[model samples]
Target chain A: MSAVKQFIPLFDRILVSRAVAAAKTKGGIMLPESSQKKLNEGVVVSCGPGAVDADGDVIPVSVSVGDKVLLPEYGGTKLNLDDEEYLLIRDSEILGKFVKVTSE
Target chain B: MSAVKQFIPLFDRILVSRAVAAAKTKGGIMLPESSQKKLNEGVVVSCGPGAVDADGDVIPVSVSVGDKVLLPEYGGTKLNLDDEEYLLIRDSEILGKFVKVTSE
Candidate 1:
Protein backbone atom coordinates (compact mmCIF):
# COMPACT_ATOMS: atom_id res chain seq x y z
CA MET A 1 0.00 0.00 0.00
CA SER A 2 2.88 2.31 -0.74
CA ALA A 3 3.61 2.41 -4.41
CA VAL A 4 3.12 6.17 -4.43
CA LYS A 5 0.03 7.86 -5.83
CA GLN A 6 -1.23 11.43 -6.25
CA PHE A 7 -2.41 11.94 -9.80
CA ILE A 8 -4.54 14.71 -11.29
CA PRO A 9 -4.10 15.09 -15.05
CA LEU A 10 -7.49 15.51 -16.70
CA PHE A 11 -7.62 17.58 -19.88
CA ASP A 12 -4.45 16.98 -21.83
CA ARG A 13 -3.86 14.26 -19.26
CA ILE A 14 -0.45 13.19 -17.98
CA LEU A 15 0.34 12.02 -14.45
CA VAL A 16 3.08 9.51 -14.90
CA SER A 17 4.88 7.91 -11.91
CA ARG A 18 7.32 5.30 -13.11
CA ALA A 19 11.03 6.01 -12.60
CA VAL A 20 12.31 3.52 -10.07
CA ALA A 21 14.85 1.40 -11.82
CA ALA A 22 18.38 2.69 -11.53
CA ALA A 23 20.71 -0.31 -11.45
CA LYS A 24 18.99 -3.63 -11.42
CA THR A 25 21.41 -5.32 -13.70
CA LYS A 26 23.97 -4.47 -16.33
CA GLY A 27 26.81 -6.84 -15.56
CA GLY A 28 25.16 -9.07 -13.04
CA ILE A 29 23.89 -12.17 -14.81
CA MET A 30 20.34 -12.45 -13.47
CA LEU A 31 18.32 -10.71 -16.14
CA PRO A 32 15.25 -12.84 -15.65
CA GLU A 33 12.63 -11.07 -13.52
CA SER A 34 10.50 -10.73 -16.61
CA SER A 35 13.47 -9.38 -18.53
CA GLN A 36 13.84 -6.68 -15.90
CA LYS A 37 10.50 -5.16 -16.83
CA LYS A 38 12.10 -1.88 -18.03
CA LEU A 39 10.34 1.38 -18.99
CA ASN A 40 10.93 3.83 -16.17
CA GLU A 41 11.35 7.56 -16.58
CA GLY A 42 8.63 9.87 -15.37
CA VAL A 43 7.81 12.60 -12.84
CA VAL A 44 5.39 15.14 -14.28
CA VAL A 45 2.83 14.33 -11.55
CA SER A 46 -0.02 16.27 -13.21
CA CYS A 47 -1.03 18.11 -16.37
CA GLY A 48 -3.87 18.53 -18.83
CA PRO A 49 -6.38 20.87 -20.42
CA GLY A 50 -4.25 21.94 -23.35
CA ALA A 51 -5.20 20.07 -26.47
CA VAL A 52 -8.24 21.22 -28.36
CA ASP A 53 -7.48 23.64 -31.16
CA ALA A 54 -9.18 23.30 -34.54
CA ASP A 55 -11.18 26.28 -33.34
CA GLY A 56 -12.03 24.95 -29.91
CA ASP A 57 -8.80 26.43 -28.66
CA VAL A 58 -6.63 25.32 -25.69
CA ILE A 59 -3.44 23.66 -26.85
CA PRO A 60 -0.89 24.44 -24.15
CA VAL A 61 0.69 21.61 -22.17
CA SER A 62 4.40 22.09 -22.50
CA VAL A 63 5.54 20.62 -19.19
CA SER A 64 5.46 21.95 -15.62
CA VAL A 65 4.51 19.91 -12.53
CA GLY A 66 7.96 18.56 -11.99
CA ASP A 67 9.13 17.84 -15.47
CA LYS A 68 11.33 14.81 -16.06
CA VAL A 69 9.23 12.93 -18.54
CA LEU A 70 10.51 10.50 -21.14
CA LEU A 71 8.08 7.66 -21.10
CA PRO A 72 7.56 5.19 -23.93
CA GLU A 73 8.57 1.69 -23.16
CA TYR A 74 4.98 0.85 -23.97
CA GLY A 75 2.40 3.53 -22.85
CA GLY A 76 -0.42 5.14 -20.80
CA THR A 77 -3.50 3.78 -19.10
CA LYS A 78 -2.18 1.51 -16.39
CA LEU A 79 -3.72 3.06 -13.29
CA ASN A 80 -3.94 1.09 -10.08
CA LEU A 81 -4.64 3.70 -7.41
CA ASP A 82 -4.12 2.97 -3.73
CA ASP A 83 -1.97 0.03 -4.62
CA GLU A 84 0.02 2.46 -6.74
CA GLU A 85 0.93 2.25 -10.45
CA TYR A 86 0.03 5.49 -12.19
CA LEU A 87 0.62 6.32 -15.86
CA LEU A 88 -2.51 7.99 -17.24
CA ILE A 89 -0.52 9.60 -20.10
CA ARG A 90 -1.68 11.93 -22.89
CA ASP A 91 0.38 15.07 -22.72
CA SER A 92 0.79 13.92 -26.22
CA GLU A 93 2.34 10.94 -24.52
CA ILE A 94 5.22 13.21 -23.60
CA LEU A 95 8.45 12.16 -25.27
CA GLY A 96 10.93 14.74 -24.11
CA LYS A 97 11.35 16.94 -21.02
CA PHE A 98 14.21 15.73 -19.01
CA VAL A 99 16.98 18.28 -18.86
CA LYS A 100 18.41 18.76 -15.41
CA VAL A 101 21.23 16.39 -14.75
CA THR A 102 23.98 18.89 -14.90
CA SER A 103 26.47 18.58 -12.05
CA GLU A 104 30.02 18.49 -13.31
CA MET B 1 -0.94 -10.53 -44.89
CA SER B 2 -2.40 -7.05 -44.93
CA ALA B 3 -2.37 -5.51 -41.54
CA VAL B 4 -0.47 -2.60 -43.07
CA LYS B 5 3.17 -2.10 -42.35
CA GLN B 6 5.94 0.28 -43.50
CA PHE B 7 7.86 1.63 -40.50
CA ILE B 8 11.13 3.56 -40.51
CA PRO B 9 11.69 5.51 -37.24
CA LEU B 10 15.12 5.20 -35.63
CA PHE B 11 16.59 7.85 -33.33
CA ASP B 12 14.03 10.27 -32.02
CA ARG B 13 11.79 7.46 -33.24
CA ILE B 14 8.25 7.81 -34.61
CA LEU B 15 6.57 5.18 -36.79
CA VAL B 16 3.04 4.79 -35.49
CA SER B 17 0.73 2.78 -37.87
CA ARG B 18 -2.44 2.14 -35.93
CA ALA B 19 -5.53 4.11 -37.06
CA VAL B 20 -8.07 1.40 -37.84
CA ALA B 21 -11.04 1.73 -35.59
CA ALA B 22 -14.11 3.43 -36.89
CA ALA B 23 -17.00 1.85 -35.06
CA LYS B 24 -17.42 -1.28 -33.08
CA THR B 25 -20.45 -0.45 -31.01
CA LYS B 26 -22.04 2.19 -28.83
CA GLY B 27 -25.76 1.92 -29.32
CA GLY B 28 -25.81 -1.64 -30.50
CA ILE B 29 -25.07 -3.36 -27.18
CA MET B 30 -21.99 -5.37 -28.11
CA LEU B 31 -19.18 -3.94 -26.03
CA PRO B 32 -17.26 -7.08 -25.32
CA GLU B 33 -14.73 -8.04 -27.93
CA SER B 34 -12.10 -6.91 -25.48
CA SER B 35 -14.04 -3.71 -24.90
CA GLN B 36 -13.37 -2.61 -28.48
CA LYS B 37 -9.68 -2.50 -27.74
CA LYS B 38 -9.42 1.15 -28.68
CA LEU B 39 -6.13 3.05 -29.25
CA ASN B 40 -5.76 3.97 -32.88
CA GLU B 41 -4.55 7.22 -34.50
CA GLY B 42 -1.19 7.12 -36.20
CA VAL B 43 0.60 7.63 -39.53
CA VAL B 44 4.06 9.17 -39.20
CA VAL B 45 5.74 6.38 -41.25
CA SER B 46 9.31 7.33 -40.32
CA CYS B 47 11.66 9.58 -38.28
CA GLY B 48 14.48 9.52 -35.78
CA PRO B 49 18.17 10.35 -35.16
CA GLY B 50 17.09 13.52 -33.37
CA ALA B 51 17.25 14.18 -29.62
CA VAL B 52 20.88 14.16 -28.54
CA ASP B 53 21.60 17.64 -27.36
CA ALA B 54 22.98 18.50 -23.90
CA ASP B 55 26.12 18.83 -25.94
CA GLY B 56 26.10 15.86 -28.29
CA ASP B 57 24.02 17.91 -30.73
CA VAL B 58 21.29 16.76 -33.10
CA ILE B 59 18.07 17.69 -31.29
CA PRO B 60 16.09 17.63 -34.49
CA VAL B 61 12.81 15.79 -34.99
CA SER B 62 9.84 17.99 -35.07
CA VAL B 63 8.05 15.51 -37.27
CA SER B 64 7.85 14.51 -40.91
CA VAL B 65 7.14 11.56 -43.22
CA GLY B 66 3.38 11.92 -43.30
CA ASP B 67 2.54 13.09 -39.81
CA LYS B 68 -0.86 12.50 -38.21
CA VAL B 69 0.24 10.98 -34.95
CA LEU B 70 -1.54 10.93 -31.59
CA LEU B 71 -1.17 7.80 -29.55
CA PRO B 72 -0.98 6.77 -25.90
CA GLU B 73 -3.44 4.25 -24.68
CA TYR B 74 -0.71 2.20 -23.13
CA GLY B 75 2.42 2.66 -25.33
CA GLY B 76 5.18 1.30 -27.63
CA THR B 77 7.03 -1.98 -28.01
CA LYS B 78 4.46 -4.30 -29.52
CA LEU B 79 5.74 -5.28 -32.91
CA ASN B 80 4.87 -8.33 -34.99
CA LEU B 81 5.95 -7.59 -38.54
CA ASP B 82 4.61 -9.59 -41.51
CA ASP B 83 1.77 -10.82 -39.34
CA GLU B 84 1.03 -7.18 -38.55
CA GLU B 85 0.46 -5.53 -35.15
CA TYR B 86 2.88 -2.66 -34.92
CA LEU B 87 3.33 0.07 -32.26
CA LEU B 88 7.09 0.70 -32.13
CA ILE B 89 6.70 4.33 -30.78
CA ARG B 90 9.33 6.87 -29.65
CA ASP B 91 9.63 10.31 -31.27
CA SER B 92 9.13 11.30 -27.72
CA GLU B 93 6.14 9.03 -27.97
CA ILE B 94 4.68 11.64 -30.30
CA LEU B 95 1.69 13.22 -28.60
CA GLY B 96 0.54 15.63 -31.25
CA LYS B 97 0.89 16.22 -34.99
CA PHE B 98 -2.43 16.02 -36.72
CA VAL B 99 -3.81 19.11 -38.40
CA LYS B 100 -5.13 18.45 -41.87
CA VAL B 101 -8.69 17.34 -41.66
CA THR B 102 -10.22 20.11 -43.73
CA SER B 103 -13.43 19.27 -45.52
CA GLU B 104 -16.38 21.62 -45.87
Candidate 2:
Protein backbone atom coordinates (compact mmCIF):
# COMPACT_ATOMS: atom_id res chain seq x y z
CA MET A 1 0.00 0.00 0.00
CA SER A 2 2.88 2.37 0.71
CA ALA A 3 4.19 2.12 -2.84
CA VAL A 4 0.69 2.88 -4.21
CA LYS A 5 0.76 6.27 -2.51
CA GLN A 6 3.33 7.51 -4.97
CA PHE A 7 0.87 7.35 -7.88
CA ILE A 8 -1.96 9.76 -8.56
CA PRO A 9 -4.82 9.42 -11.03
CA LEU A 10 -5.55 12.14 -13.60
CA PHE A 11 -8.71 13.95 -14.64
CA ASP A 12 -11.69 12.25 -12.98
CA ARG A 13 -9.97 8.88 -13.11
CA ILE A 14 -10.10 6.76 -9.95
CA LEU A 15 -7.74 4.03 -8.80
CA VAL A 16 -9.42 1.30 -6.79
CA SER A 17 -8.29 -1.88 -5.10
CA ARG A 18 -11.04 -4.46 -5.06
CA ALA A 19 -12.15 -5.85 -1.70
CA VAL A 20 -11.39 -9.45 -0.89
CA ALA A 21 -14.22 -11.92 -1.11
CA ALA A 22 -15.69 -13.27 2.10
CA ALA A 23 -14.69 -16.83 2.92
CA LYS A 24 -18.00 -17.58 4.57
CA THR A 25 -21.58 -16.73 3.70
CA LYS A 26 -24.03 -14.91 6.01
CA GLY A 27 -25.40 -18.35 7.02
CA GLY A 28 -21.92 -19.30 8.31
CA ILE A 29 -21.21 -21.88 5.63
CA MET A 30 -17.61 -21.83 4.60
CA LEU A 31 -17.05 -21.50 0.87
CA PRO A 32 -13.94 -22.29 -1.12
CA GLU A 33 -12.06 -19.36 -2.65
CA SER A 34 -12.99 -20.44 -6.15
CA SER A 35 -16.67 -20.68 -5.23
CA GLN A 36 -16.79 -17.27 -3.62
CA LYS A 37 -18.63 -14.74 -5.67
CA LYS A 38 -16.59 -11.79 -6.76
CA LEU A 39 -17.98 -8.68 -5.14
CA ASN A 40 -18.32 -5.42 -7.08
CA GLU A 41 -16.99 -3.36 -4.19
CA GLY A 42 -13.75 -1.51 -3.74
CA VAL A 43 -12.05 1.30 -1.87
CA VAL A 44 -10.88 4.43 -3.59
CA VAL A 45 -7.11 4.48 -3.43
CA SER A 46 -6.71 7.61 -5.51
CA CYS A 47 -8.95 9.97 -7.44
CA GLY A 48 -8.55 12.94 -9.76
CA PRO A 49 -9.94 16.38 -8.95
CA GLY A 50 -12.75 16.15 -11.54
CA ALA A 51 -13.60 16.30 -15.19
CA VAL A 52 -13.60 19.60 -17.04
CA ASP A 53 -16.77 20.88 -18.66
CA ALA A 54 -17.04 22.53 -22.07
CA ASP A 55 -16.51 25.90 -20.39
CA GLY A 56 -13.22 24.72 -18.79
CA ASP A 57 -14.71 24.66 -15.29
CA VAL A 58 -13.83 21.60 -13.23
CA ILE A 59 -16.59 19.18 -12.24
CA PRO A 60 -15.18 17.62 -9.11
CA VAL A 61 -15.33 13.91 -8.56
CA SER A 62 -18.04 12.82 -6.15
CA VAL A 63 -15.96 10.25 -4.24
CA SER A 64 -12.68 10.79 -2.51
CA VAL A 65 -9.83 8.58 -1.36
CA GLY A 66 -10.89 5.98 1.24
CA ASP A 67 -14.49 6.00 0.02
CA LYS A 68 -16.14 2.60 -0.34
CA VAL A 69 -17.85 2.54 -3.72
CA LEU A 70 -19.80 0.12 -5.83
CA LEU A 71 -18.21 -0.69 -9.18
CA PRO A 72 -19.72 -1.68 -12.48
CA GLU A 73 -19.78 -5.35 -13.44
CA TYR A 74 -17.36 -4.65 -16.26
CA GLY A 75 -15.32 -1.84 -17.80
CA GLY A 76 -12.21 -0.21 -16.31
CA THR A 77 -8.55 -0.47 -17.15
CA LYS A 78 -6.75 -3.13 -15.14
CA LEU A 79 -3.38 -2.21 -13.71
CA ASN A 80 -0.72 -4.10 -11.86
CA LEU A 81 1.83 -2.56 -9.56
CA ASP A 82 4.26 -4.49 -7.38
CA ASP A 83 2.25 -7.69 -7.77
CA GLU A 84 -0.99 -5.99 -6.62
CA GLU A 85 -3.86 -5.48 -9.06
CA TYR A 86 -5.83 -2.27 -9.27
CA LEU A 87 -8.61 -0.90 -11.46
CA LEU A 88 -8.59 2.53 -13.03
CA ILE A 89 -12.00 3.83 -14.01
CA ARG A 90 -13.77 7.09 -14.55
CA ASP A 91 -15.54 8.54 -11.49
CA SER A 92 -18.83 8.58 -13.32
CA GLU A 93 -18.60 4.83 -13.87
CA ILE A 94 -18.97 4.24 -10.14
CA LEU A 95 -22.52 3.23 -9.27
CA GLY A 96 -22.72 4.58 -5.73
CA LYS A 97 -21.03 4.72 -2.37
CA PHE A 98 -21.78 2.73 0.79
CA VAL A 99 -22.68 4.78 3.82
CA LYS A 100 -22.32 3.51 7.38
CA VAL A 101 -25.29 4.13 9.69
CA THR A 102 -25.23 4.40 13.47
CA SER A 103 -28.15 4.33 15.87
CA GLU A 104 -28.63 7.34 18.09
CA MET B 1 -41.75 14.61 -40.80
CA SER B 2 -44.35 17.13 -39.60
CA ALA B 3 -45.68 14.65 -37.05
CA VAL B 4 -42.13 14.31 -35.61
CA LYS B 5 -42.17 18.05 -34.87
CA GLN B 6 -44.83 17.51 -32.21
CA PHE B 7 -42.43 15.47 -30.03
CA ILE B 8 -39.53 17.01 -28.18
CA PRO B 9 -36.62 15.35 -26.38
CA LEU B 10 -35.65 16.30 -22.81
CA PHE B 11 -32.40 16.93 -20.95
CA ASP B 12 -29.36 16.29 -23.16
CA ARG B 13 -31.31 13.61 -24.96
CA ILE B 14 -31.63 13.65 -28.73
CA LEU B 15 -34.22 12.00 -30.89
CA VAL B 16 -32.58 10.59 -34.02
CA SER B 17 -33.90 8.97 -37.14
CA ARG B 18 -31.21 6.78 -38.64
CA ALA B 19 -29.99 7.35 -42.17
CA VAL B 20 -30.81 4.82 -44.83
CA ALA B 21 -28.09 2.44 -46.00
CA ALA B 22 -26.70 3.15 -49.42
CA ALA B 23 -27.65 0.68 -52.11
CA LYS B 24 -24.47 1.39 -54.07
CA THR B 25 -20.85 1.55 -52.97
CA LYS B 26 -18.62 4.58 -53.55
CA GLY B 27 -17.24 2.76 -56.58
CA GLY B 28 -20.77 2.97 -58.09
CA ILE B 29 -21.36 -0.76 -58.02
CA MET B 30 -24.99 -1.47 -57.25
CA LEU B 31 -25.82 -3.86 -54.42
CA PRO B 32 -28.98 -5.40 -53.05
CA GLU B 33 -30.59 -3.79 -49.98
CA SER B 34 -29.95 -6.90 -47.90
CA SER B 35 -26.27 -6.81 -48.82
CA GLN B 36 -25.77 -3.21 -47.81
CA LYS B 37 -24.15 -2.62 -44.48
CA LYS B 38 -26.06 -0.73 -41.80
CA LEU B 39 -24.71 2.76 -41.22
CA ASN B 40 -24.18 4.22 -37.79
CA GLU B 41 -25.37 7.64 -38.82
CA GLY B 42 -28.49 9.63 -38.13
CA VAL B 43 -30.13 13.04 -38.34
CA VAL B 44 -31.14 14.74 -35.12
CA VAL B 45 -34.89 15.27 -35.08
CA SER B 46 -35.15 17.00 -31.71
CA CYS B 47 -32.78 17.79 -28.90
CA GLY B 48 -32.97 18.85 -25.27
CA PRO B 49 -31.94 22.27 -24.04
CA GLY B 50 -29.13 20.70 -22.00
CA ALA B 51 -28.38 18.72 -18.89
CA VAL B 52 -28.14 20.29 -15.45
CA ASP B 53 -24.89 19.99 -13.59
CA ALA B 54 -24.52 19.35 -9.87
CA ASP B 55 -24.73 23.08 -9.27
CA GLY B 56 -28.01 23.28 -11.26
CA ASP B 57 -26.39 25.21 -14.10
CA VAL B 58 -27.55 24.09 -17.49
CA ILE B 59 -24.85 22.55 -19.69
CA PRO B 60 -26.19 22.95 -23.18
CA VAL B 61 -25.98 20.08 -25.67
CA SER B 62 -23.53 20.57 -28.53
CA VAL B 63 -25.59 19.25 -31.44
CA SER B 64 -28.74 20.88 -32.79
CA VAL B 65 -31.85 19.67 -34.53
CA GLY B 66 -31.19 18.44 -38.10
CA ASP B 67 -27.49 17.92 -37.46
CA LYS B 68 -26.03 14.89 -39.20
CA VAL B 69 -24.16 12.97 -36.52
CA LEU B 70 -22.37 9.70 -36.01
CA LEU B 71 -24.04 7.22 -33.66
CA PRO B 72 -22.62 4.50 -31.50
CA GLU B 73 -23.11 0.94 -32.63
CA TYR B 74 -25.13 0.14 -29.52
CA GLY B 75 -27.05 1.66 -26.63
CA GLY B 76 -29.99 4.07 -26.80
CA THR B 77 -33.68 3.53 -26.22
CA LYS B 78 -35.77 2.60 -29.25
CA LEU B 79 -38.99 4.39 -30.04
CA ASN B 80 -41.77 3.90 -32.57
CA LEU B 81 -43.85 6.86 -33.67
CA ASP B 82 -46.22 7.22 -36.62
CA ASP B 83 -44.88 4.01 -38.16
CA GLU B 84 -41.31 5.32 -38.04
CA GLU B 85 -38.54 4.18 -35.72
CA TYR B 86 -36.40 6.61 -33.77
CA LEU B 87 -33.68 6.32 -31.18
CA LEU B 88 -33.41 8.35 -28.00
CA ILE B 89 -29.80 8.83 -26.90
CA ARG B 90 -27.73 11.16 -24.79
CA ASP B 91 -25.76 13.88 -26.51
CA SER B 92 -22.57 12.63 -24.91
CA GLU B 93 -23.01 9.27 -26.59
CA ILE B 94 -22.74 10.85 -30.02
CA LEU B 95 -19.28 10.27 -31.50
CA GLY B 96 -19.24 13.36 -33.69
CA LYS B 97 -21.11 15.51 -36.20
CA PHE B 98 -20.56 15.34 -39.95
CA VAL B 99 -19.51 18.56 -41.63
CA LYS B 100 -20.19 19.21 -45.29
CA VAL B 101 -17.04 20.46 -46.99
CA THR B 102 -17.43 22.58 -50.10
CA SER B 103 -14.56 23.86 -52.25
CA GLU B 104 -14.49 27.59 -52.60
For candidate 2, write residues B55-102 as lDDT tens digits: 647689999988999999998777665579888789899999999999
The TM-score obtained for chain B of candidate 1 when compared with the true chain B:
0.31
Q: Over the stretch B1-104, how does candidate 1's per-residue lDDT look in tens digits?
A: 23332333334766556776545465665555665555668776556556544333457788787777788777676654446666767777667777867799
Candidate 2 regions with alpha-carbon error over 4 angstroms: A1-5, A26-28, B1-104
Classify candidate 2 by CAPRI docking class.
Answer: incorrect
- Model 1 DockQ, alpha carbons vs. true complex: 0.01
Per-candidate TM equals 0.26, 0.49
Recovered native contacts, candidate 2: 0.00
Strongest candidate by lDDT:
2
C-alpha positional error of residue B73 in candidate 2 after TM-score superposition, expressed in Å: 21
lDDT of 1 at B31: 57
- Give the CA lDDT, 0 to 100, for residue B72 in model 1: 75
